[model samples]
Target chain A: GAGVSQTPSNKVTEKGKYVELRCDPISGHTALYWYRQSLGQGPEFLIYFQGTGAADDSGLPNDRFFAVRPEGSVSTLKIQRTERGDSAVYLCASSDIAGAREQYFGPGTRLTVT
Target chain B: AQSVAQPEDQVNVAEGNPLTVKCTYSVSGNPYLFWYVQYPNRGLQFLLKYITGDNLVKGSYGFEAEFNKSQTSFHLKKPSALVSDSALYFCAVRDMLDTGNQFYFGTGTSLTVIP
Candidate 1:
């Protein structure tokens, strides 16, 4: 079985540019999550989706961050007007259900904003 | 205000020696605890979880964690540390009250096992 996977393993972009990170969750997973990890730090929650609806978006740092899961299998995290502070590894995870505490993570999309 | 804490920034041990990584958590209600490991240039891998039942929970890669309710701690331990076990370990906690389903992670603890 294929675990969660992300596209564009590494992305280098300039500040004020827009970028999108994609995630393909495991088959049959109804819950998807996005997190950001900075150097020497643990992952921080960004957004969570149960089914096709976002169950929680409180973790999103600001209005510039947004995510969507249209068909409920694949998800995309979009960041508008990227900043140097956004330079981090963007991680995606999925679980069987929203209540399931265990999550399978993807290799992540490392975004370097210069 | 759900949060997790890993007191040590790093832990060093020799191969074949016993290892311990401490984690503490705070939540409003019964908590669900989890442990994860991250290798360099890799995503986080789930190690184990404590949702209910027995206090001692075993997980992947010959790892186990002991959940202590009184101490509000879930410490990861291994009988014999291997050089390959060196990586960053994270402790996470989820509040039972919140239906949003999000895990709050610790600062992470780097493990270094010398062979």
Candidate 2:
């Protein structure tokens, strides 16, 4: 079976620009999560979605970061007025309803704010 | 707050030699411990997890982790290292008792398997 997939392996943009990163989770996964990983650091949680609604989003750094999983299978992480500090590899993960704790990750989309 | 710690920044082991990656966590209640490996330009791959019951949990690629309640540790171990095993290793913890049920990851340890 295909694992989770993220679009746009790499994206470079100027500061203060808006960017959207998409993620396609594994088929039938009801839970989705977003994380950001800076160089030399581990991934930091961003947002979490259970079904169509976001169950936990406290990890989002600020208002400029937002995520949506409207249909429950696909999710998008949007950043507004990106800053150089926001440059990092964005990761997406999905897990089955039965075992929500064990998640499967996707190849991240590296976003560089130039 | 709940957190995980990987004291070692890097661990180098010779091929065919035993290897161990240390992990310790602090959480409020019964925790869910997990180990994940990441290759360059790739996503994290799940290695093993310790939920309940057994203290020793085996996982993919001949890797295993031991859950120690006294030490609050879940160190990943393998009998023999392979050159291909070189990668970044992460230890994560989920405090199920917490309302948020969010996962906390360690700083990560870079493993180098020298041939």
Best by DockQ, which number? Answer: 1
Per-prediction TM-score: 0.98, 0.98
Per-residue accuracy of model 2 over B1-115 as CA lDDT, tens digit each: 7999999999999999999999999998888999999999999999999999999999999999999999999999999999999999999998878766588899999999999
lDDT of 2 by residue, A1-114 (tens): 999999989999999999999999999998888999999998898888889989899999999999998888899999999999999999999998623368999999999999
Query: CA lDDT of each candidate?
Result: 0.95, 0.93
Worst 10 residues of 2 chain B by lDDT: B95-104
Residue-level lDDT of model 1, residues A1-114, one tens digit each, is 999999989999999999999999999999999999998788899999999999999999999999999999999999999999999999999999877459999999999999
Q: At residue B115, what lDDT does model 1 achieve?
A: 93
Instruction: List, in order, the clash count of every candidate structure.
Output: 0, 0
TM-score of the candidate numbered 2? 0.98
lDDT of 1 by residue, B9-108 (tens): 9999999999999999999999999999999888899999999999999999999999999999999999999999999999999998988888899999
Error of 1 at A43 (Å): 0.7
Chain A: TM-score in each candidate?
Answer: 0.98, 0.96
Model 1's chain B TM-score?
A: 0.98
**Runs of candidate 1 exceeding 4 Å displacement:** none
